[model samples]
Target: MDLLPLEVAKKVRRDSTLVKYTDGQFIQSRGDSKPGISIVRSGAANAGIIGMDGSVSMTTLLGPGQSFGEFTIFTELPRTHDVTAVGETEIYQMTATRFTRLYDNEPQLSRALLKTALMRSHILLEMLDAIRRLPIRERAARILQSMSHTAGNPNKLECRQSELAYTLGVSRISLNRGLKQLAELKLIELGYGEIRIPRPALLSDWVANHCNPAPLAS
Candidate 1:
């Protein structure tokens, strides 16, 4: 989902507590009973699972303006994934009680929350479809494009190759090969721990032409 509107975010910040976390600190853990929404005010957070073998499989990277923990509040369930700070991070946290109060009295807050939930659902469906139907190369391109769009930074993705491989459910070797192909195509420029798309539109157009289906016969 996109960032909340400035005024709405300001309202949320006004009612929320600002908390800081160092790198690798857990903001919320799986199965935790806390019911609160945490929005990244600075730095980033990673939501994912730690396997029994202690391997981390990151599912989502949440940057500034992105919020988490809403599902737990709505469903009255435990936190589903472990959310950890990526670096020195600041978060604005609002408890379920406070959020409910604001939600009841504020139309804009309700609309923003609903919009985030809907957008998240839509993105989840798209990710599932891409994983099922697209090749690794195309899948990588789409994901990079999505991240760039979300962050409004067409040139850089602050993500590692290993993280991308885990997200794609592919081996590091396979992901490397796919990335190499993209680099050869000059669609992306790879760096130490990031991927850069100099022209995100070109990558988007390329994915559309290759991955989109042709029109059916009349």
Candidate 2:
């Protein structure tokens, strides 16, 4: 979902607590039922399901301008997925009590939350359709893109092969082949527990041409 507007973001900064997390730290776990939300102010985090088979199926990669724990806050339910930092990260936490206060004080906050929730819902449908239809290579590429941030030089993705394979619901062997191809195509560089995307746009262009049903009007 989109972030709060600049003025709104600045105002909420006072009501929230900024917390740091090291890579692999859990920001939200299945054990916690606390009503709170975490906005990624700096780095990114992964939110996913741990399957009964001990595999992880990634549901979301929340980067800067994104959030987690909204479902838990509204429903007052136990966290349904695991949220782990992608790297050293900072998040702004809003507790249910604090948010309720904000909702009562600033009506705009509720509007922002409602807008973000609606947008996320629509995006989820589009994502499911794309994931089901795209080739495995395209799917992996998409996930890699999300983790990259895409601000300036592409960053190295800090994830192991097994983890990537598990989250993507593909065999390690298949994932390896995709990584190898990405490397050969100069789209990414594979390292131990990392994949670096040097030219992020190359990956985007490949997906657009290979996976996109309609050609871009350029």
lDDT of each prediction vs. the true structure? 0.81, 0.74
User: What is the RMSD of candidate 2?
Assistant: 3.8
For model 2, the stretches where C-alpha displacement exceeds 4 angstroms are 51-54, 107-115, 118-123, 146-154, 214-218
Clashing pairs in 1: none
Task: Show how many residue pairs clash in every candidate, following the order shown.
Answer: 0, 0
Q: Which candidate is the best by lDDT?
A: 1
Among all candidates shown, the one with the greatest TM-score:
1
C-alpha TM-scores of all predictions: 0.89, 0.79
Report the Cα lDDT for candidate 2: 0.74
Residue 158 in candidate 2 has what lDDT? 60
Q: Which stretches of candidate 1 lie over 4 Å from their true place?
A: 1-7, 151-154
Lowest-lDDT window of 10 residues in candidate 2? 146-155
Q: How far in Å is the alpha carbon of 192 misplaced in model 1?
A: 2.2
